[model samples]
Target: MSGDIQPDSHANGHLNGSSERPAPLTVAGVAQRLGVAASTLRTWDRRYGLGPSAHVAGSHRKYSPDDVARLERMRELTLQGVAPADAARAAVAFDPAHPEASPAPSQLVRERAPVERLLVDPLSLAAAAVEPDPRRVKRMVEQEVEDRGVVRAWTGVAGPALEMLAQREKTDLPGVEPESVLRAAFLTAVRDAAVRDDAAHRRADLVLLCADESQRLQAHVVGGGLAEVGVQARVLRAEVVQDPSQVLDVVDRRRAGVLAVFGAVPGAEDLVTAASERGDVAIFLVGDAAPSLWLPHVHRVRTLSAAVEEMAAAISTHV
Candidate 1:
């Protein structure tokens, strides 16, 4: 990593001149280093006053090492269950210039006592969902995704909690609005996992679409799972596409190598028929609601994990 950092000629004076300070990084460079979006960094700056400290005339803003460190701390804290506003405040207050003044990563983990308690057992998460503490539930779900891969995290924690919520809804339980909380948290995790930095994989066209308008969650699961293996997918919600032609347009535009349609919503058969007509792209049918009558050239799978494996295999063979 040290070798990757080269001193800027402008910062370091001429051959005979004394060496100057190291060059700060641009927004893109810092974003790549931190594994976050450049827009996210901009948002932090605008909202939390965490912008670059060093500014050169007639040039773009550049972040010093200290600024990077502070932002890194903020990201770490936010991911570990700290509220963004609170995390930003703490990060801004931290003295990144003084290494000893900053708390260790382990200390940060220890600070999240409430969230830690919720993650102590699977039963605790389910119990928390009964009362529906949205913040706690979101944090637990995020932590699970970080610890386990997307597939395992969804299947083991988020999926079961959601199932419990469905059961509670059937009984008309009070204070249970799990849908909004779960959807937001799950989408956030999916965005975080779906990093498209690899040039080779970026061109590999893989699309995951929901067959039914209400069955959007399964598409997210498949997208997240595909992301774990470094495959980026274009996720199309069911409502976004009106008919088979629209789905075909997306596939053609993306030059999709593999297309996985999830859910058992109405008109799925028509969509499958249209996709099957395209001989080049491998089509897959996934989820419990998948069509009972399997058509030629359509690969069917029951679970998200299986869909992920099938997608990976198709990409490997076809792309």
Candidate 2:
């Protein structure tokens, strides 16, 4: 709104020789414009000084056209495999008068080397998840599954990316939105990859449950992987059931031969004990912090394939 530094109106939609100044954009608006998460914009602003120049003291920051252009340049550079810090420097030095004068080819190559690993790597998946770009994340995740199968895709792509997000949550922002977005995309992809056994006489042989909602993806991936090998695994959510004992009831009703639990569920020993007592059932404790339960037929597994293979073997033996 200041007379000394009005951004180009054309950049913000004013055109056809119009002289009107464009409306200022809030952080959310700019985030929407750039197809990135609001958290990402805040991170850039805090670390790279790419915040709105129109920001006034004691007022909510709003991006001017020039600010948006700089961010656009920053995004472009980063997407081209340029490191964020390097891209920020280039973005800050962007000359609005010559917007086409982007970072030189030589500069791009020099800056891109360090970040090239992001292209089709777990780093890229994590970055996409942080950005919370559902469509892109969904495609990339499913592609990993299609190319590497459920087990590899979960271990090499989705799992690592999710773990990265979880770690970042502890060190960075205190919100679950980014993780939730990635999980949604991951579950969609894994669920779609499932090769369900639809035969009327084919009953589910295994019942899968996560320790909590956070481990839902692991359970789903295991279920999907089991389905691929012609094993029927029923995925049950402990959170969805009113009581933990109800999970056991479902298992009994389904006549599930294998009970595989992912992650460390608090006070799950009772359920594990009950399941273990079912002489006909095989119990599996999965993940790094698998519960140390004093029960029989308890198989501890740490990897997706191990869990699937063990459950499949149990089912085959039971049959």
lDDT of 2 by residue, 1-319 (tens): 3435444532444444456656779878999988998657755764567877685554444788778888888898899997678788888877655767756534643423431112456778888877657777877877776556677788887778877877774443456476777788877776665532223114445555545655667888888777655567767766643355887777777778887777666556767877787777788888877678757788888888888878877786674
CA lDDT of 223 in candidate 1?
82
Candidate 2 TM-score, true structure as reference: 0.56
- Model 2 pairs in collision: none
The deviation in Å at residue 147 for candidate 2 is 1.0
lDDT of 1 at 135: 74
Candidate 1 lDDT, tens digit per residue, 180-282? 6676777787677666222223444665565565567768777877766546687776665557777788788877778777666567778777777777778
Q: Which pairs of residues clash in candidate 1, taking residues 3 or more apart in a chain or in different chains?
A: none
Measured with C-alpha atoms, the lDDT of residue 164 in candidate 1 is 66
- Per-prediction TM-score to the true structure, in the order listed: 0.59, 0.56
lDDT of each: 0.68, 0.70
| Candidate of highest TM-score | 1
